[model samples]
Target: MPAILLLIVSGFYVGNTVLAEYVEKEAVKVPLEAYLKGHETGKPEYMQKAFHTDGKLMFIRDGNYTTIEFKDYIGRMNGQPAKDEANRKRYIESVDISGNAAVGKIVLDYPNARFVDYMSLLKIDGEWKIVNKTFNVEPKNSSD
Candidate 1:
């Protein structure tokens, strides 16, 4: 009787663990899809959907740390696809989730530069929203 109960309890736990992983991955992908759409369409609305209103973008420029609020970045969108749309690509590399928090990495390739972005997200009000992003950009043809 004791062995049978143990087996049943163990199976339940295993099933729940698998389900949790699947749920987390799918949830994390929601914001990423929105992010990709924003870049592809050059629409600020898509970016607004993917990120929290107060999200911040951080990077280093000329040996100085710089930060841009999401609002400021969205203001620069031109509402048209980039001129190099033919050469543009965005790829989601990986995502790791713990409870309601997650981190994701993606690569963006443009005609003039390549960027790898690491985003931090939180599941808020039943939806995942990007809270922060840090990225490294390499200009095309740069020797470094």
Candidate 2:
């Protein structure tokens, strides 16, 4: 029984190494770039990975800074309904790319929520990950 267990463990290790080596390069970056680009073009599906599964969002308003889970951010965004094509026009005005790191300035222009968002991103072990985010809605009398 011990021998059988040892063999199984060794086999699993070998298989894992082979699979890791066989994967193509730029494979992961494609999905990440696509997701960021989607925000520029307003593809909801692409917005999915912009946050980690257990990601958090931090922002400030009215002299207060608050942090919330990714799901809450998604829920708030989704809760507000918009007309056709309105959803896709939100653009990332600029994406500052530095090797594997990037920062995107996202401008969301909804009827009730017109804000400029800054996303601080990192290449966590080759995966594009959002580390910190800060944004504020354009207030009345403020130039967009």
Number of the top candidate by lDDT? 1
Model 2 C-alpha RMSD vs. true structure (Å) is 11.6
Error of 1 at 84 (Å): 1.4
| Per-prediction backbone clash count | 0, 0
> In model 1, which runs have C-alpha deviations exceeding 4 angstroms?
1-5, 142-144
Report the C-alpha lDDT of model 1 over 1-144, residue by residue, as the tens digit. Answer: 999999999999999999989988988988888898999999989999999998999999999999999999988998898877887899899999988999999999887799999999999998899999999998997443
Model 1 clash pairs are none
Task: Give the Å error, residue 63, model 1.
Answer: 1.4
Locate the minimum summed-lDDT window of 10 residues in model 1. 135-144
- The whole-model C-alpha lDDT of candidate 1 against the native structure comes to 0.92
